[model samples]
Structures are given as C-alpha cells and as structure tokens.
Target: MKLYQRLHPGVNLGPTDPENHEEAEEKIFGFWIFLMSDLVLFSVLFATYAAMSIQGVALGPSPKDIFDLSPVFLETMVLLASSFTFGLAILELKYRKNQGRLALWLTLTGLLGALFVGLELNDYRILLTEHGAAPQTSGFLSAYYLLTGTHALHVSVAIIWLIVLAVQLATLGPVGPVKLRLMRLALFWHMLDIIWIGIFTFVYLYGVVL
Candidate 1:
C-alpha cells in the first residue's frame, strides 16, 4: 500500500487525500458532469427569459434604463477577487498546511460574497424606488428578476454555506469532513465567479451596450 493508503483511517473505497491529483482529476470530471446538468437547468431559465422578454412591457423601464454597468463592474470584481482568494486558501491548505490562514481567507471569501449580494439588493432597491422599475413593471423587469434573482439566490446559498463551513473549520479543523467540505466550497465559489462573469458579460454589459 502507498504511504497515504496506510495512513488513511477510512476505508480506501476511494481516495484518502481529497486533493490528491488523480482523485481531484476524477472529481473535477464528475463535477463537470453535474455542472452540465445544472447548465441544462439554466438553459431552460434563459429560454423562458427570452420568451418573456419578447412580450415587452410598453411603459416600464428597459435594461437600458435600470442597469448601471459600474456597480456590476464592482460586484464582478469582488467575486473575481474572492475566487482568487479561495484558490489561495486551497493552495495554502494543501501546500503550506495553514488552518488559521485558510479559515481567514474563507471568511474573506464570505465577506466578499456578502458584499456582492448587498450591492445587488441595493441596486434593486434604488431601481425600484428611485426609478419605478420594479419587477412587476415590465417584461424586461420580469426577465431581469428571473435571471438576476436566480443568481442572487445562488449567492445567498453560497454565503450560508460559507458560514456553515466557517463554523465547521472552527470546530473540526481542516481534515476529513472539514477538508472535503472546504474543497467542495472552493469549487462552488469559483463556479459562482465564473457564472457571474457570464451574467455581467451577457446580461449586463451586452444588455447595456447593445
């Protein structure tokens, strides 16, 4: 048996080192499979949004009126930075063997995510009160609510997850279940950042520019 194999207390039905290169490769492939399924779900939502957008509301503000690229730009930057921080957290956990630093970085990740959501909510409030562009006001509003709200819901969930993991890291430290959970969380955070990039590009930027 390999040294890692001998050291692992759990049954070697699979991998011991969760981030072991070979195991990580297999896991990433599996995650991509699951992500494909998720993509299908998002595709359906996009199609729905597209269909609804065609039935445009006559009186309400369109994307041109409601969206400001500047806030979105900042939100995107925060998430992108958080993704990089998560990568650093993982690298630290794997290479440097630093638990306090790992948790600190993860906490920062959570804060960044919270900041993004806060900005989103703030934007929505401003749009609704200041501009009278609530979701009920337009078909464009409907689609905007559906798409951005979906992503916001996702962000909320991720934040909750980060909080839970923060607790876990505090009590359990970075091994076994904690380690696996953190690794999965890292993947999730990265995925959110990438998805936000698409949202900003396709939904916000293109929506604005075009």
Candidate 2:
C-alpha cells in the first residue's frame, strides 16, 4: 500500500514492516513506554491533589472560594480547540501533503495553547491577589498549584515544540523523519488533552459542584 493510504491520525507510521525497519518499531514502542511513564506521573499528581484538597483548606480559601468556573471553562475550551486543530494539522499532512495548510493548522494549535496558558496564569494571579491564596498559604493551595502548574508547564513546552516543528516542516517539507517526529508530537499533545480532561473534571468541575 501507498504511504498516504496507510497513514491515519493517531496511527503509528513507524516501520510496521518488521523485516525492513525493526529499529523504527522499537523506537516507537520505546516512546510509547515513555508516555506511559508520564501517565503515571500525572496520575500521582491527581491523587495527591484529591487527597490534599479535602481538608487542607486550613483556614485558607476553599476551592469554591478561589476557583472561578468561567475562566476554567474558557481554558478548557481553548486547550480542547488546540487539540482539534492539531488533529487537523495531522490530517492535512497525512492526506493533503500541503505544507502551507499544515503550517496554518499548527500555528492555530500553538496560538490556542498559548491562550490556555495565559488564562491559567491569570487565574493563578487572581488566586494569589484577590483570594490571598498562594502555594504557601495552605496544603490545598500547594497541591492545586503543583497540579495545575505542572500541566501548564507541559502546555508551555508543547507550544515551544510546535514552533520548532513548524520550522522543521517549513524547511524539510514533511519528509520521513519530519513525519515521524510530528506523529510523536501528536501523541504527546493528545496525551496532554486527555490529562487536562482529568484535571477539568476532577479539579475544576468537582471543586465547583462538590
């Protein structure tokens, strides 16, 4: 089969034909293992937040007092939209092979990611200033900052990666290595999206509702 025919979103493009490129398969598998390790790290962070948040308010503001659902909702929408745009970029590269179109989609993805980070920082500022809540204020606040700040750090890295990838795509024009790197980056980006969903549900929605 042709390369484009075999390529699909979220599908591994690394040498499936074991006889020809066994090394490529190994690399892809190793990258997956790395992602799994990251999952564990995020899982731990989530558990810590859940545990520490219950009674760690410690005379400080509660989640309901500090978390504004409006900005949280907006941040969630922005990140989700970035993920969608990234999927579009992948489709463009896999099907259309239009470098310009792919660049446009990737740029949109980066912009949305930046917006999410900006909103998150603004939220943090509000928590610190308006509510007098900082990481040092209480255990709950510390956990909250650690969890959300870690996720924000990942988002920041992703935005930087997107910029670098865009430059590579512009210069190299989606060659084999470029395509493989893009696929790996896509996996990482999608993983962040999934992690954010956990954060939104467990941290934001739960905080507001419960």
Candidate 3:
C-alpha cells in the first residue's frame, strides 16, 4: 500500500511479499503476452466478419432478420454488472479479507456469466429454429457464429476457471500464488468484458442499424 506502488497488475490490488511480488511480476508479464496474442486472434475474426457481413447473406436470413436487440442488450448489461461485481470481489479480498463475502461476489459473477451464455444460446436457438439462419446457411451467419461462439466459449472456460479458483481460495486461503492466479483471472475476465463490448457494438448493434 505504499505511495507510487504497483500491485499485481490490477487497480488498487494490495502488495504481497517481496518473493511473491517478484514472481507475480514475471507471471503477469507472461500473461500480458498471452493476452496480446488473444487480441490478435480476435482481430482476425473481426476482419473476417467485416469482409463477410456485407455480401455473405446470399439468400439466407440477413442480420436484420436474425438479430434481436433486446436480449443482446440485456446480456451486455449483465456482463458489465458481472465485471463490477468481480472488481468488488477483488477489492474485498484486498482490503476486507472477508472470505465469505469474496466468495459471494464470485458466485454472483459466475451466475451472471452463466446467464449471459444462456441468453446467447437462446438467441442462437431462435436464429436457427425460428429464423432458419444456421451457420451453414450463409457466410454472414457463419462468421457471426464463429466470432460470437468463440467469445461465448471463452466465457464458459472463464466460469470454470472461476469455480476452480474459488475452491482454491476456500482451501488455500488466498496465499501468494493463489492471489497471483486471481490477479491473472481478473485480467482475463475484464478482457472478456471488453471483447463483448466490441461484439455488442460491431455485431449486434451494427447488425441492427447498419
């Protein structure tokens, strides 16, 4: 908590032992490298989507036909809320050290994530069954499925990771390594939130308006 201190690659994270801090710096730097790679991957998908969205329908259902803004907007709000709850959980651990409250927040975050996935799946169901817009139906649908599905897959993985970490925190009591892991997970979760914002804007919102 020193002035001009940097803690665990997050905002307002508490300091750790020197040994752990040094190790965390290395690991978090590596994590940054991984995130950069992931950014490149998403960039490619976005480019692909942009290329296909215009002419890809080819007699299939267009974005206007398949996209329902209401559920997507709700999903966006839920995910943004989950990010806020996760931030609360981290700050709780940093300052309050209340394991129960921290776990509660984690649970809430996971539930929100699950809700997001469910909502997306429902949208998929409607697109496929009601709108007859499966991925194989057109290039636009294919690209849309690939991009959004990849993101949803990432969220599912993160939720599983969250459960694992919660168990570790309960059993391991937030030791140095565990806190470092939590820091990495926090970065990953926040990154997903950012990516979803892109999807919301570029895919869903643009699909509707443009």
Query: Highest lDDT among the candidates is held by which one?
Result: 3
Flag the better candidate by TM-score, 1 or 2.
2
Residue 133, model 3, lDDT: 85
Clashing pairs in 1: none
TM-score of each: 0.83, 0.89, 0.93
lDDT of each: 0.74, 0.82, 0.87
RMSD from true fold, candidate 1 = 5.0
Best by TM-score: 3
Runs in model 1 lying further than 4 Å from the true structure: 1-30
Question: What's the distance in Å from true for residue 99, model 1?
Answer: 1.1
- Candidate 1 on 1-210: residue-level lDDT in tens? 654454322312134354454454455557667767766766776777666654675688666677799998999998888888888887777667677798788888889889999999998899888998888887778777888888888889988988998888788776656665667667767777777787788778766776
How many clashes show up per model?
A: 0, 0, 0
Lowest-sum lDDT 10-residue window in model 1 = 7-16
The sequence of per-residue lDDT tens digits that candidate 3 reaches over residues 22-59 is 67767888998999999899999999998889988898
Q: What value does the lDDT take at residue 201 in candidate 1?
A: 80
Q: For model 2, which pairs clash? A: none
Candidates sorted by lDDT, best first: 3, 2, 1
**Among all windows of ten consecutive residues in candidate 2, which has the lowest summed lDDT?**
14-23
lDDT of 2 at 8: 41
